[model samples]
Target chain A: MERELKLMKGNEAIAEAAIRAGADSYFGYPITPQSEIMEYLMAQKPHERTGMVVLQAESETASINMVYGAAACGKKSMTSSSSPGVSLMQEGLSYIAGAELPCLVVNVQRGGPGLGTIQPSQADYFQTVKGGGHGDYKLITLAPSSVQEMADFVKIAFDLAFKYRNPAMILSDGAIGQMMEKVYLDPQVPRMKEEELPSWGTQGKKKGQDHKIITSLELESEKQEKVNLRIQAKYRQLEEEEVRFEAISCDDAEYIFVAYGTSARICQKAVDMARERGYKVGLFRPITLYPYPFKQLNKLADQVKGMLSVEMSAGQMVEDVRLAVNGKVKVEHFGRLGGIIHSPDEVFNALLNKIIGG
Target chain B: MDIKDIIKEENLVYKRTNVLTENIMHYCPGCGHGTVHRIIAEVIEEMGIQEETIGVAPVGCAVLAYNYFNVDMQQAAHGRAPAVATGIKRVFPEKFVFSYQGDGDLAAIGTAETIHACNRGENITMIFINNGIYGMTGGQMAPTTLEGMKSSTSPYGRDVEMMGYPLKMTELIANLPGTYYVTRQSVHTPGNVRKTKKAIRMAFENQKLKKGVSFVEVVSNCNSGWKMNPVQANKWMVDNMFPFYPLGDIKVPQDK
Candidate 1:
C-alpha cells in the first residue's frame, strides 16, 4: 500500500514504471532524448531489485531483435530509442508484429527527415500510427502529453499489448522526455513465474509439453492471408474497445484544438488563452494514436465550427483529424518544424488566424 | 530373412532421433543442411536435453527449420538469429539455446549481429553452414564465396578486386575474446560428418559451462547452386573450399 511520489524526468519515470510493472527484460541502445530510460534502469540495477534484465544492445537493430526473442518467449520485454534508431528498428518491428508477439517499444521523438535535431518533434506520427514498418500491422500507440502519463502509459501500453498479443509503442517527444514533473510511482508487481508463462511462447518444453514454434513466415498465401485477417480483426476490436482521449472544456465549445504529446500541452494553454478572450475554444487530446479517437472527433465536428490540428511537425496528425471530421467541419493544421516548440500565444493566434480570422 | 524379422528392434543398429519430427525437410537432395540437422537432433537426443532446448532458425533455406526441430523454436529475420539467441539465453540461462545459420545469413547482412553476439560471449551455440554461395536464393554470390568462385551473381567468377575476399568467419570470430570454442568441419565424407557431429556436441556442452559463444562452422557443398552434380560439387568442395576454409579447430578452451 506504499505509493511513492517523486519528481522525475519522463524518461526516468518510464524506466521505473516498467520495473514496477514486472517487465522481464529491457534491451536497448543509447540514443539522444531517451538515453535516460536505459541509464535509469542500469543505475537502478533492476536485476537486483525486480529481477528485470537490462541489456545495452550494440544498436537499435540488435535491441529490437532481442525484444523479439524475449517476447517470443512470452516475456514482458521493452526497448527505447530516438528517431533514427527507431528507423533502424523497422524491420525487427515488422517481424515482431507479423509473429504476433507482445512487447513495448518507446520512441522519444526528435526532429528528423534524417537526424534533423535532438529537440522534440511529432514527425513520426505517420510512422508510428500508420504501420511504420511494412505490411498491414498497427501498433497500439500511446501518446503521453505529461511526465505522469509518461510513467503511467508504460504499464498501460504493456497491458494492452499483452491483451491483444501484439506490439505496442509509447510515442513521446524530447520535451516530455527531458522535462521533470511529479509522478506517482506504482508499487512493484511480481514478475511472472515460469509456470505462468504463456503456452504459445517459444520457451523450452517440459515433459509432456508440446513444442511451440514462433514465426512470421508462412509460404502459403492462403494461410498468410488468414493470419493477416486475424491481425486485422484484433485491430478492429482495439478500435471498438480501446479508444482513449481527454476532452478539456469541449462541452460547449465552437472551436477545438486537436493535438497530442507536447503539442497537446501547448494546445491546452492555447485553449485557456482563447477562452479567456471569450472565443469558446477547447482542447481535444487523443491518448491512443493508433486506435484514434475518430468517432468522438467526428461527433464533436457536428458541434464545433472548426478545429486546429497543432503539432511539432509539418502537419502530420492533421490528416487524421481531417479524416475524422470528413468535411463535417473545417479542420486546419498549424505547427512549427525542426524542433521548434510553439508558444501558447502562437497556437492561439494560429487558431484565430487559420480557423477563425481567415 | 523375412522383412519384418530384419526390421526388428533387436536387429536395429541405428534409429532416427526423436528430436527430429516426422515432417519432410525442404532442403535439396544431397544438401548439407539435412546432414547437419540430423547431427544436431542426434546430439540433443544423446545429451537428453530435447525437452530443455530452444533453437533459432535463420532466414535462408532453413527458415522452415522449425517444422523439423521437435523442440521449441523461433524463426528469426535474416542475420538476426544471434541477437535472438542472445535474448533467449539471457532469459533462460539454464536452457540450451542455439542458432542455425547459413553463410549469407551469418556473414553478410547479419554480420553485425553475428560479430557482436560472439564478442559478447553470449553463452549460446552457433551452428554455421558455410556453403560458399546463397543457395536458397538461387546461387547468388555470398560473403563466403571464394575468390574467382562462380555463382549466379558472380557468373564471370568473383573478382577479388570487385567482390572482395571470402570471409573466414570461424577464424575471425575465434580471435574475439568472447568465443570459448571455434572449429571448422565439413560433412562431405562419413569420417568428416562424425567429426562435425563431435564438434557440434562439444559446442553444446560448452554452453553448460556458461562460456561465451561456441561456434561450429560446417564447410558444406551446394551442388544445385554450383551448377554441378552432387558428386562433382563434393569433389569441388574438397579440392577448393577446404584449402581456403580448412578443416580444423580455430580455437578451443584453455585449461583453467
Candidate 2:
C-alpha cells in the first residue's frame, strides 16, 4: 500500500507515526514543544481507528507508570514529554529498564536546570547516554535531525525497543519538534499478533505456559548483579550492531563538527559555510546517541586536524566527544544556554575561534 | 466398611484454595497480608476467574505477592501499583485487574495514584492495607499512623504539628464521583475474615458491571512493626484502630 505524504510538525509526526506503527497505547502529559503530541493524539483518536488507547495522564509519573503497565502486558506503549516532565519519568524509566520491558519515551527537550525554558537545548546528552536514574542501565536513544526523521524514528524506535526488550527514546528538541516538514507516513502496520508477543506478559494465564510476574526487584545483591550483567550484555550487543550516525563529507577534511538533533542541523549549514572558506570542514551527526558514533568519531579524529562539539547546552556532550577523541585532536565545545540557540553564523565563528584559528 | 466410603470426595467441606500458589508465604506470622491473600485467592477460585485475573503487586511487605497468587501479575514501582493496574485494566478490559498495596506504599507515597485512579473511576479494584506504620521499612511512621503513635521515624510519637494528622484515605477516596463501591473491612477475626472476603468478591464483581472504581480498604495490624504479639495487636486494632477507621461500606452503587 502506498503511504500518503503529509506536512506535519515533528511532534505531530510522532503521534501520527505511532498510530501508523500500531502502537497499542500512548500515555502523555502536555508540555511546551511537545504538547502537540498529546493534542494530536487526542484529536486523532487512535482508539477508534486502531483500537489503541490514548490517555492524558495526571502527571508524568503516572504517564510513565501507565507505559510500564502496558509494556509489561507486551503491548507497544509510549509517552512523550519535555525536559522537566522527562526528569519526573526517570524513576519509572529505571524500573522499566530493570524489569526489561519494551516501551518508547519521547523527550522533546527544552532548556533546563530547573524550569529553564520552553526553548530547545541539548543539555540532556549525558542524562540520556549515561543512565539517567539510579543504578546502571542504558536507553537506546535516537536523535532525529528533521521532522521526517522524527516521523521515521517512531517506528524504528519501537522496533529496536521490542527487539532488544529495552526502552527506546526519541530525543528531539523544540525546533525539530515544532518545525513542519514533508514526511512519508508509513502505511498502518498491524499490532503484534496475540501469539507474537511475549507470553510472559500480564494478559491472564489462558494462553501462557505459566503465571507471569513482571518485577524489577531481585532483592538479593548477587542475583541483582546478574540481572545488571545481563542488561550490560544487551548494551554491548547494541554497541556492536546498532551504532548509527550520518557522516557528512569527512574525507580529507581538516576540521569536523560533531553534533546531533537540531544542533546537527545548525552544524550542517556551518559546515557548508566553513567549506566555502576552504577549511575542509564536515559534520558528524550521531543518530543513536547512546551507542554513540564513538568509533567513527575516534577514527574521524585521526583523519581531521581538530574537532568542535556543538550543542545547545553548556558543553555536556563535548565531554563524550573528548572521551572519544582522547587527545588525538584537541576537541573543544561551542554551545548556547538558557534557551539561547546559536545561529549557524555564530557556530561558524565559534568553529573558527575554537578549531580553525591558530 | 472402608473409612473412605464414609468420607467421600463429595462430602469434603474444607480444602485449601487451588488458586493459591504452592510457594511458602513470607509474611509475618500474624500479618493480615496472608489473610487477605487467601481471601483473594479463594475469591478467584470461587468466581472461577483465575484465567481472567491479573494482579499488581506493590513495593511493600507483600512485595512478593506475585508468588502467592496463580494469576498473571505485575510488580509496580513503590507506590505505583494503582497506576500500574490502571494500565493493565485499560489494555485488557475483560481481565479482572486489582492492585494490592500497603499504608506506606498507598497512603504516603502513592496518595495521588490512589486518589486519581478512584476519581477517574477506572474499572479496577484497589486493595489498600492500612497498618498505620511502615512494615517493610522497619516501623517508620506512615501517613495513616495514629496520632501520638511512636514509630522509628517518630521516636517521640507522631506530633500533629510536626507530621500532620493521620490520613483517612478511604474516607477521602469514597467522596470521589468515580467510585462505584468503597468499603473498609478488617480480617482480625474469623467473622471479619468472611466479611472481608465478601467485600473483595463484591469489588471483583463490580468490575464486570463496569460501573466504576471499586476500592476495598482493610484496616489491618502490623504486629511486628508495633512491637506486640499478634493477639495483642488484633485487640489493640479493634479498640483503637476501629474507632478511628470505622468498618463499613463508605460508598455503594445506586444501581445495587
- All candidates: CA RMSD (Å): 0.8, 1.8
> Looking at model 2, what is the TM-score of chain A?
0.98
The DockQ of each candidate is: 0.84, 0.79
Q: List the residue pairs that clash in candidate 1.
A: none
Model 2, position A18, has a per-residue lDDT of 96
Those runs of model 1 whose alpha carbons end farther than 4 Å from true positions after fitting are none
lDDT top scorer: 1
Once fitted onto the true fold, the runs of candidate 2 whose alpha carbons sit more than 4 angstroms away are B1-12
Question: Tens-digit lDDT track for model 1 on A1-358?
Answer: 7879999999999999999999999999999999999999999999899889999988999999999999999999999999999999999999999999999999999999997899999999999988889898999999999999999998899999999999999999999999999999888989999889888998787677668999999999999999999999999999999999999999999999999999999999898888889999999999999999999999999999999999999988999999999999889999999999999999999998999987
Query: Any residue pairs clashing in model 2, and if so which?
Result: none
Per TM-score, the best of the predicted structures is 1
Error of 2 at A165 (Å): 0.7
Residue A71 in candidate 1, Cα distance off native in Å = 0.7
